[model samples]
Target: MEEIKMNTIYDNEKFFNKYSQMTRSQKGLAGAGEWHTLQKLLPDFTDKTVLDLGCGYGWHCLYAAEHGAKAVTGVDLSEKMLAVAKEKTAGYPVNYLQADIATLTFPVATFDVVLSSLAIHYVADFKRLILNIKQYLKTDGILVFSVEHPAFTAEGSQDFYYDEKGNILHYPLDNYFNEGIREANFLGEKVTKYHRTLTTYLNTLLKNDFTLLNVVEPTPATELLALPEMKEELRRPMMLIIKAKNNL
Candidate 1:
């Protein structure tokens, strides 16, 4: 088993430069494939304190602040990513922190809402992270997060199986029951991601006293479907979004 340390993969100059060029990095929430669906699942942010784990470029943090969140704290391990987040965030009640999502701590009942966008899959211990989230959230606080779907990670390739003629035949899936660290190639580099079954994702929250609200296997935003490549998303679920409440 490869030990999962503080993940600073996003800080690598080559990887950071390439990631900075992604549509999501440039256009914020509008460029995210699942934002259309995920946004609908979020509770109103009015006057709420928000904590965004693995907050990347802090799009969600800014959105919360812009929409009346009392305060927003965005945490990520990459100094470069945080630098960009801070540079773009001005006159908004948003704070950027350079910290590891797997070990960062917050006081109890510290926030009214907690969010993570496509980032939790990198943490090695999902249960511990959420347990801390449960403790940090106020009573009835909302938690919304999205991650790369297990089915997409099951095969370790995070890609499609193509035919001899070069058309994508299907997304390959195997070793699905075996969940753990996966070495996946992303942006032409080996990236480390953790895989957990859908059941584990839901059951962990249930056992930890979270009331399940909704589970989404999101498709590309409707407008994105017009793009030739986006249409392929219909064939497989690449992301999972979950909304839950602290049932205290």
Candidate 2:
């Protein structure tokens, strides 16, 4: 197996420092508004074994445990994040493993569900990760994950720019075809991320024999829409959520 390089951005104190302060609900899976959307796509966790890839802070692991999961295993590369996860998930039927999710190994058919939230984008070999996930999940097991939207990542830049009047401006769409590593500022820290087109994400699952279940680009709730700052998300999707099943 080829060794996969781990992205150390999350391990940086600057990023996790800000992340550590946020509550689980405030983080909301990928973002603040997508939690309910993700929840709707989830299968019943009652007594199921679940694995959360790149499980930062153990939020989803704890969530699975809370929802009657028999065992929840969380894998993350960041020791700092794992420490926080351990502290937060103490006493839960959850295990936190500090390992590069891309290179982590598990027994075949070990999990009923594999979950990831905005984590795989940091992985360079997403195809390998998907294939490994297929091996880890039981037949009919589900994989649910969210990532930075291809449209958003395509631009390389963040979002729309406005004039002094705050009127809508053009949203940049550049290099949509170029899919690879991208560097950007996150919470004032320069970070590395891997960008893959929507087709790449879909075709990867299909090529691995995963049956598509659902795809969602969530919209903010009414309360969020009430904020002027949140209106831009309505203009363009920031995240992509996908649910697929292991049919083989």
Candidate 3:
């Protein structure tokens, strides 16, 4: 993936601040499943120093603070995102910093947990990112994150079509296990995302002095299943949750 820019509306602090506020108005971000997912990860957070990478608007950071975390620090490439994060986290036990994830400069061994949710895919230099995250996590510290499923985003494996029964089938428009770099959309435009097989991710985690503990594939919610158009693919993975612990 190349160094592509974020949408200007999302790049500027003023615009991003409003953008985030607007998102909160829409419906839900940490809707039920996410709330429960966080509950499942609670052991990783209690009384811990947490670093939230790509912490868009500080949603998880704020949640961490509310959950008895000693402190939560969030970092993001967009000053705007960070700015809004700062505002959103005000009066809470969380701090927001503006920085690019690919070149983060957190002090070595500084965090008990380095977590990210739905954000790491934006990094172009993912290998370097894997290495850098090690610098901040304490030994036995965990790296827990969620991202778009590689299988769903892979080239030939990604498609939205129908079968003989007229039932919708959303399968590979490309290979499910290819080293492909593609882009996802943000407000009708494109942003780069790397598509790697699960083995690729596992290998990278292993090479970085970390061990995989779990991989959770969240099924679509009841609301999604209730939608006639989404029922066919309800059993499919909508996102992937990965958990690992640093051994170094």
Instruction: Identify the leading candidate in terms of TM-score.
Output: 1
TM-score of 2: 0.90
**Every candidate's lDDT:** 0.89, 0.83, 0.70
User: Ten residues in a row with the worst lDDT in model 2?
Assistant: 1-10
lDDT of 3 by residue, 1-248 (tens): 23335523368444444454542323335442444554475454688999998887677788788877998889877766777678777897888777777788778999998888777766666678888889888889888888777766676324457899977665545566556667664433455666777777778999887988888876545654564534644545546788899999
* TM-score per model over all chains: 0.95, 0.90, 0.81
Candidate 1: the clashing residue pairs are none
Tell me each candidate's RMSD, in Å, in order. 2.3, 4.1, 4.2
Assess the local accuracy of residue 175 in candidate 1 as a C-alpha lDDT between 0 and 100. Answer: 95
Which candidate has the top score in lDDT?
1
Candidate 2 lDDT at 67 equals 96
After superposing all C-alphas onto the true structure, candidate 3 shows an RMSD in angstroms of: 4.2
Worst 10 residues of 1 by lDDT: 1-10
lDDT of 1 at 57: 83
